[model samples]
Target chain A: MVEPVTIAVDVMGGDLGPDVVLDGALQALRADSALHLALVGPADVVEPFAAAHDRTRAVAATEVIAMGEHPAAAVRAKKDSSIVVGCRLVKEGQAQGFFSAGSTGACLAAATLVVGRVKGVKRPALGQVLPAYARPCLLIDVGANADCKPEYLVQFAQMGVVYMESIMGVSAPRVGLLNIGSEDTKGDEFAQKAHQLLAASVPQFAGNCEGGNLMAGDFDVVVCDGFTGNVCLKTIEGTAKTLFKYVKDALMASLPSKLGALLVKGDLSRLKGKLSPETYGGTPLLGVKGAVIVGHGSSNATAVANGIAVAATTVRANVAGVIADTVARAGSATPGGEGEAAASDAR
Target chain B: MVEPVTIAVDVMGGDLGPDVVLDGALQALRADSALHLALVGPADVVEPFAAAHDRTRAVAATEVIAMGEHPAAAVRAKKDSSIVVGCRLVKEGQAQGFFSAGSTGACLAAATLVVGRVKGVKRPALGQVLPAYARPCLLIDVGANADCKPEYLVQFAQMGVVYMESIMGVSAPRVGLLNIGSEDTKGDEFAQKAHQLLAASVPQFAGNCEGGNLMAGDFDVVVCDGFTGNVCLKTIEGTAKTLFKYVKDALMASLPSKLGALLVKGDLSRLKGKLSPETYGGTPLLGVKGAVIVGHGSSNATAVANGIAVAATTVRANVAGVIADTVARAGSATPGGEGEAAASDAR
Candidate 1:
């Protein structure tokens, strides 16, 4: 029999508070018999849910980090906060992974500081699976390092490949560097330097992928600096929401359109389900020592449950360890270390 | 009586070549009695169309700059290219503005190097009017300066204000710095520093605007470095296209859905029209001494006609002169000149 992977859930985090998180955790526990959850929050908040589930346990924490608080400072000061405590559980080997729909900054801070970075990894990246034309594409460094060096992108690409292959079940994922244009000479100095390094090193490198081509799903993995990636991600999200709203408004403008809307409502719902953030569960903070899944702050119960499932799956695949191994191998293959060489060249 | 505004149209440029451009130019001339076009291209290609319209005249240009060629090199080597000649018409006071549905880089290079930058303006920005929820918002520096100094953003805001107030007719346009977060301290060094400068100098500074809030039309002007703006613009384009395609596919999945689609065809057409790039005509290359408009290479007759109309409107408003005046006032108001001070501080 396979051993159950214990995943720590931050019940006190997220906009919905502990109640929604606890309910979601219970749902996740019921769905997977081989999964275990440690619901971390105030004793009174987590007890009822923990007592009802056979594979669930309660881990009490005293404080909660506000979404607007400075991440590192809050994590350092509030050692008993759900986010910090949950990450600590993973660090202590009590849990294989951590899941939170909390303050993204806080989760990133606690995960990097408490659970720690994988050995030989320069910077951890936030990898998100987005719906595209042909298949789902994984975008790395969505908001980890806004200012990035060329070597950092190289490592991001490696981590992305590992995650996509192991978790998403894609073989030899095609990697692309997101830029303003398809030409290698496009973009800023940083992008130019990164392109050269990626072309030289990353075997699956597909050259420059323009922003307009991202949803075409021509490549499996797209790497970009956190700033551009964040803008792109949010732009897509905003555009999708706005477009749907526009379409709905148009559909309801007249009787004929209203009847049409009623008839096609099911198909619309299916499209929405496919495009929903919950479908992808959460973005993984790859290259961390343990599995760290950060869900949308406005995530519902389904999203939370999906996030926990993602955490469990990532833990089972040992994504962090694989990333470390990949980085080490790449570093050894290049003389004087790829990171050092890129840094020197940049200087 | 108001005198006609003479505009130079690059008849040889664009994907469809001279025929489509001339057809569009003739249409613009027919629509507006107070508009005259100097059709700049090979004499043989433009003469037939030019002779057909009372307000149209042909100017001979011997060479054409390909879209894929390097901008600066091509402009230097092909001095008699249609793009260069069109801008030269504006420079020689033969035309009040120049329009091209050709290579963006070439137009930018020719406009900056030939027509020249307004006095005290450090960088000329590409300003695009995007349809937003409340109103059309102007996004500046879409792909001009990939690597930007904080002061350049300040100038961009000033230019945006001028364009919005003079052209878009927005009274005291609110300008927002585009960043990952809305916080004052959010984003990278450039964004944070630019936010500070903008807040200090720009009268209508609306603080930081996140990417998701862009389509909401909360701010009149959204400013960012060229790279992020380019990514955001293209991502929107790609996402919109993908979503529409998905909707179409869903509608065609079954007979019932197809019937519903037929009923709501008008509504769908309206939605598509609102989101179409052709609706905006072209993006104005702001801060150039003379009006220079760059349209999409795939522009149709309607889009080309709209581009010509936009050029005429901008020329009548004297956007470049107003921008120069605004910059001069801002520069004089600051003790050490905001640009120099910000540049030194950034260094």
Candidate 2:
């Protein structure tokens, strides 16, 4: 008899609001018998789910954070907000993980402030597992710290390595620093310094990986500052969407192409599935004390359910604890290990 | 009849070297009777083209800059190099423009140092005309100034607008500041400051554009620092290639899908053409005293021809003189215009 992994779900988040969130939570609960969910929202919104499932619990909250509101300010003001309360549940040890398809800024804020950072971790990076040609690769700091130092990237690499090893079950993950070019001398002062730091610190440091080779599947983990990473991720998504739209428009331009499109409909659907963010479920905010999964703001029911599953799996794997250990090991391996330890302690 | 526009071609540049360059130069000369080409390279490589075409002239250059050589060092050391000599021809009024399908770094260095910068222009930006949903958009600073200040971005926007309006024939082009978020307060310190400067200076400023909206055709000109713009451009190219590869694999997986692919071959070719970098030919190095066009290193004969035609069109339109005038007007339009002019004079 294994104990069920409990996860807190923010029902009042995302663009779709509570109804879609509640439905997704219910679907997730039904799919896994060893899974438990604490649906946090207004009483009316969450009470129905709590009453229906034996493994589900309702945690009432009155306030909701708007997507456009300043994240830190909103989190600070709305203590009873669904996002904040859900994270608080994880902080209190009532849940092993927290899941939200909400305002990304709000989720990041609450997760870092409420659930807290793992010991010795300077910043928590938002990581996404994206499908590449050969296999899936993890990209860290998709939108966490936009202005990052070389030391911060080193930490991001360590966290990414640990997450890939423990959660994705990859041994000795190859870490690549994302830069403008593959050469060591490429990029600006920050990227140059970061490359040197990563080369000295990380065990499986593969040199620089250009943005063009990101989907080539040559790297297991790619580390970059949030600004560049965010642009890279969104560019991929946008270009994919635009390309498909262009193809569809081209196909429907004439009768022969329309017939061709009909024949390959199944293949196209499969291709879409491979490229869809929902297939990967949710992105994990690593280096936090508790497992935190942030889904797309426009995620559907399937995506939300998958996000919950990811949260449960991450919690079961104890990713937070593993990340802490990995960062500590990486710190001790460097010549300035003692200084790094002292700085972390001071923080 | 209008007087013929003379442009310099780096006959020894690109992967295919002199053969493809000479062939493409001949094709351009044949296509446009009013175009004259100065083929600059070793006598053995360029003399044949000069002898074959009445309008083509051969200029002897003894040295070639390899793609891997350090850009500044190569430009300084190889005084008789084809790229340096080509730019020198343009600088000395023998040619109105210079074109190369060779090392981008070398081209940039030679163009900046030899061709010179427009008066009052701080830095030259590399601008590429990429296809969007509705029309083509000009992306500036693709690889010119990697680490750019906010003022540099403002200049880029001004240059991008002028290029799009005069060359692409867009009236009052909408300028967009490329950032991770659409909000004014949503980027790093650099982006935030650049946004403010652009909003105040650019007449058709469209506010901040997220990476995802880059291909949506919502803006006519998108501006970013060289690093982010380079990454964004490469990411798009890489993603498009990967997606097409994925689609081809999916189509060939089964007989029926393969048949469907055959039926849509024409449509597929059209889609590929729409996404091909070759369709746009070359990226113009804006802000230089003379027009300088940089083509892809892997350019085929047809692509090379298109690049030469682009150079001819840019020269005919007097893009460099117009850019200088636009910058002078923009500098004076701002309150600190006198100080900027003083700084330029000092430089």
Candidate 3:
């Protein structure tokens, strides 16, 4: 049998530390046969997992940045920090990619600063897959770059298009710019200018999309600046949390409603399955030199495995290469090219 | 007792028409003693409600607007349209204000064209009270003017602040520009230009606010163009709907979780009360000469009652007058007041 590809795991990442991180990594290993792991963190953090299960599945790359430390400072000071060490393994070619459930800020800093950007990417973006009605719609720049030029969004659109196609198997995904309305003049100054820039510079735009259409699956890929996308994503998450309480209260307030809720429970679960943040467990930091999947900090065992699988799938799909290749082909539409893409979208 | 002020209600509005509208009107009368409703529609629609309920509290202002008719075109064409008839009552001092659960486009058109804007008010805005952990937060220009000028957002800030202080009882509500980020220079051209104008003109802007802080209770009044606000509002609504499904599935996943849900059901309901769309039911179309509360077409009786209460509260608190007075005092700032607020921010 061929030797399995080793993936680097940021063992010190996440709020619950090694317990949740270790639980997730172990579960991930069980789910995938061809994957081995380089678990990077303090010895104490990595040793317990090594003692419990198959030591053959993971090798410790010990040391870590404290959760409270500045991400950039930590990366510089803590040379062996879990996030740094994990990304370093990929940089050194010992591992294909890395997965982390830690400080999104620090993780992003290390990923770009260490692993670098793809060949012609103008700016890297944190691309997320939202579980909409028809299929998972990918929204890029969830919270990486706050300031976005029209050209940056165009680059993000191209990169997001490639990631969705290669990793998710979506072909010729319709690209849409997230805006207040679908009309050309309906957005802020940037959107209006971006519309002009996109139509003239980029060929993939499916036109403008409203926020209400997120669930309606209006397009395959939704492109926006990180600030707007992050706000949109988190606002949705907050609203979902808020609405869950309301619907439950409505159902339980009366006997008839409760009975109806019970009858429809299976349908409800199926609907939930279609929308769970866990089903698509990780958001890929696209346009990076290497694959970096940012898993939810609150993720459990199943989610962690899913995140690792996502990173591996991205690596396997050669997403970064395709992204670099696509932008290179796009040419002058992207002026700064790979160098601009590498640094502009960092935390 | 002195006669209650009449509120002209459009019975022909909304998907359910007179039945739900009448139900909501009756609910409103029962909840508030000062409510005198002038229910407007054809005799067929209003006569039934008058027959079943005490006519002393409700009067039929007979007229009807066809659903498919154009709002502005219909208001001018169909002089007998209920929405127009209702606005006429407010114009003639037969009613203090108006409320409609009809076509949003129709309601705003009727209110603006019929009642008109306050003197020197170049633009009017729809200010919505978004439920928050603290008192409800106000966001102006939800969908009033699709296109916004920098001067218009500044005007909205002044009006939104008055609405918050008067109706929500927030004293000196921290006003903020809803931008992609907190930086003064961040966001699109309009936002950047508006930042300069707001700093120059408006008095209480707390500085630039990122989209993520919309719920964090940082600003009492968050101002953005209609397009961005609509997108942000819809995104929040969509996300809430999505999360609502996830929680239901989690609670019903197994027997123990279901049992746990039982104990926590009351707490869940209380939480729902804070987040429900009904808590802050109506959005006041600010800058109008008279009070006008626009309830959503999907609103239930509770939401309708809350809308009535909100209109009554704004009028009662003299919200519009406060805005008129504030602008008068700050009128000496400059032609556009673009640099006045900026000078203050610089301090």
- Judged by DockQ cut-offs, is candidate 3 incorrect, acceptable, medium or high? incorrect
Candidate 1 vs candidate 3, TM-score winner:
1
| Model number with the top lDDT | 1
Displacement of the residue A195 alpha carbon in candidate 1, Å? 0.5
Please tell me what DockQ candidate 1 reaches: 0.59
lDDT of 2 by residue, B155-220 (tens): 898889888988889998999998889888888767776787788888889898888988888899
State each candidate's clash count.
0, 0, 17
Give chain A TM for each model in order.
0.96, 0.95, 0.89
Candidate 3 chain B least-lDDT 10 residues: B338-347
> Which rank order by DockQ, best down to worst?
1, 2, 3
Pick the TM-score winner: 1
| Model 3 quality (TM-score) | 0.75
lDDT of each: 0.87, 0.86, 0.73
Residue lDDT tens for model 3, B172-269: 88999987556687665567778887887777888887665776667899898776677778777666654555565666777755765675556556
* Chain A agreement with the truth for model 3, given as TM-score: 0.89
* Residue runs of model 2 more than 4 Å from their true location after superposition: A1-3, A335-347, B335-347
Query: TM per model?
Result: 0.97, 0.96, 0.75
Residues A1-347 of candidate 3 have per-residue lDDT tens digits of: 43466678887777666778777877877877877777777776666666766633344555666555666777877676788888888999988889998877688889888998887665688988997755779988887775566568888888888887888888888988888667676566567666776776667787888887875577888888776787678766655543544565666866655665665556556665556567797888988877899887777767788898888777777888888788878875544432242221221
Fnat of candidate 3, please? 0.24
Task: Write candidate 1's Cα lDDT for B1-347 as tens digits.
Answer: 55689999998778987778877887898889999999999988878767876878889999999999999999999999999999999999999999999999999999999999999898899988887776888988899887777788888999999888887889989999889898899987778778888888888999988888888888999998887888888888899999999999888887788889988989889888888876777989999987899998988888899999888988889899899898998986643345353332221
